[model samples]
Target: MTKKLTGVFLVLLGLFATGTAAVAAPPPSGSTDPVGNDVSWPQCGKTLPVSPAFAIVGVTGGLANNTNPCLAEQLAWAGKSSTGGTSQPRVAVYVNTANPGHSGSWWPSSNTYANVTVSNPYGTCGSGGGGAGPVDLPCSYIYGYAKAYDDATIRGVTNPGTYFWWLDVETGNSWQAGTQDATALNRATLEGMATYFKGITAGKKGPDGKPAGVGIYSTGSQWGTIAGTVPPGSPLAGLPSWLAGAKTLRGAKSNCSLPGLTSGSSVAVTQYVAAGLDYDYACR
Candidate 1:
């Protein structure tokens, strides 16, 4: 999507529910303190106004049909831009995962949907090896591993350490609707992704020495519509939140205190647009 169209869609999404700060919480434990931007093909080749502290690049399309063409360039630029900074500019990846059964997409005959999500991002980032073999599990579990595998391969990360790994959940993307089961499925999908990232294994570990800490990049309303409330004591309940929906830097800052979607997770980041540039506000 073009930046203009994306901006307009975000505007229509209402820039998060407006209100006074409902929660005062410190940044999540083990999270790096830095501002950043998340971009896909739209921002490619455009000069950013300031060097971001980090960047999260999208790896695949909503339906896992295509890989972002500029992921390598974006990653390379992120690496170069962080030179001489207080810390190396962190680079993370996000993937668009949806239900193939209800989202109007046909499951590939040869490759399971989860395998496709993993391979598409991994292969696109110059890691051409195929994904781990398909798991005869729920689609969500498969997708989680698919995303984790792709992220590990792209960064050449070899340890199961903590790093930012966001799942892009938005209404603009394809999703299943119409019943409580849909909500259950959606939650399962997210948990599946998180499970893969946090699980320990000799080969699954990334170079960062820990698994990627999973976060949700969506607003309360969108998440409710897509997956319902994250149940208490669920695996996803304690994950950090990356709040979306802000039109300006001030708006993003104000949103820093909104109630977190995850009960105990800190609201770690807020996304906003300023002067046609997408920016992030890391909650301190």
Candidate 2:
């Protein structure tokens, strides 16, 4: 990856840090919190046109847009009105671990509006490398976002609609779905996170008053390969999918490319620009 793309990824993960003193907390209940990070690939910078047609918020350059600013900007775009559609934009927040969860305010006073979204934290790559176990890190781990979200932060939230995404940029370069064709340790870690999400928001509510889905972020070939092959009765079978890729989303053979393949209510948020910004869209 080019230096520019690498930097953009760093900034995107950095958005998760909330306060000065980072702390040690439980991993968000999405993945197993296994000892690794999610994977984020570099793009050629040719992103798709900004659209009001999708939901999930894909953070890009902190363009300092008034209509949107940081997390709020992403939410604003997701909730904006399309030219002629009634689709309500859905905003997503990366559970950033760079900064601590919050201090005085329940939500981090990033000076950004509590857009009801945040991303998971970790260094540029996602895993902190402290690697205590499947997923454990020091309080100061740069990309170790687990510390940012714990019992303390959520209990303090006046608005729990701000869904927390346990995003990791660390999927092995290959899919571990079908055969026992590889690292059981890594796969277990990833599965452990999926188990976590089932309970993360066991007591939370959505912006529209519904249970939110624990997100799984990965590239199509990586996540889809495993998720695609899991049997209907598998524990990880019901998880939601967040496929990362810019160009594929712009085209028709997007996440929904395969027939009869239910990504368990999936969304494809691809990097449209080299600015580390991405946006997801609908198949139909």
Model 2 scores worst on lDDT over the 10 consecutive residues at 60-69
User: How close is every model to the real structure, measured as TM-score?
Assistant: 0.68, 0.44
Per lDDT, the best of the predicted structures is: 1
- lDDT (10s digit) by residue, model 1, range 152-245: 4553433334445677777766566775577766676577667666553314322333334667778888888987877786668977777888
Task: Return the TM-score for candidate 2, rounded to 2 decimals.
Answer: 0.44
| lDDT of the candidates, in the order given | 0.56, 0.33
For candidate 1, the 10 contiguous residues with the lowest summed lDDT are 17-26
Per-residue lDDT over 1-284 for candidate 2, one digit per residue giving the tens place of the 0 to 100 score: 11133333454654454322112223222222111111111221222223333334323222111111233333433344222122222434433112211210121222111342233232122223432222221112211222223311432322433454434332332222334533332333244344444446566655644345455555555444433455454334545544445443334234445332233544433323222334333333
